[model samples]
Target: MTYVFNMHDAKTKLSKLVELAESGQRVQIARNGKVVVELNVVAKKSRPLFGEFKPLNIWTSEDFDEPVQEWIDAFAISQSELELQSNKK
Candidate 1:
């Protein structure tokens, strides 16, 4: 079914017009008895929610999460040098 409303009537009853359009009925707004604009219900798209987990097809070694040996050794050396300088002061 098609429902037509004049500009002033459409503005006052906007919500009712939207409801009618969403229910698969044609709705039109007119000016001086000539149709000017139409109202339609846009389909809602599905979206992924925040923090949704999706797995990637990638692999890593068991030690990938561990700190590198060279970095650990450098840090230890820096720490020992700092301690020696503090002891001398």
Candidate 2:
């Protein structure tokens, strides 16, 4: 649920508002009667770095089979065709 507070009330009760926000409540601070800012609680999760020290391998078997120029020409042709179709519309 969202808790709405005017500017004065929000400033006076800042600690209590923070406590509520930390407990998963959305706090809206309003100037006069209009909402101006919002405070949200974001939960962060821990991630494991299992592959941090893995060796990098750039060369593959396919790289030897196909020339780099062939891939670049194909990509350029497709991009031009896409641009032509978009311009028609």
Candidate 3:
């Protein structure tokens, strides 16, 4: 079904018009009695999959998932050592 509404009428019924368009009906808004714009349900986009960056020429190193030494050392320190370091700051 197709629905047409004048500018003022469309403004007051904007939400209803959107609902109609989303339900697969054609909705049009007019200005000065001539149709000028349409309301449509936009097609939803799919989320990109994992490792989809290859098309963009981006690559990761083999060691990207390896444990980082600095992070390991930070986590290995004792709670007292962390408190002493904070006090020194």
User: What TM-score would every model get versus the actual structure?
Assistant: 0.54, 0.48, 0.55
- Compared with the true structure, the alpha-carbon lDDT of candidate 3 equals 0.91
Residue lDDT tens for model 2, 1-89: 99999999998999999999999889999997999999977788777589866688777785576668978999999999999999999
**Cα shift from native, residue 85, model 1 (Å):** 29
Candidate 2 regions exceeding 4 Å error are 45-89
Cα lDDT, all candidates: 0.95, 0.91, 0.91
Q: Is 1 or 2 the stronger prediction by lDDT? A: 1
* lDDT per residue as tens, model 3, 44-67: 998889987556667999999999
Q: Which ten-residue region of model 2 has the weakest summed lDDT?
A: 58-67
Angstrom error of the Cα, residue 3, model 1: value is: 0.3
Which residue pairs show backbone clashes in model 1? none
Residue 12 in model 3: shift from native, Å? 0.7
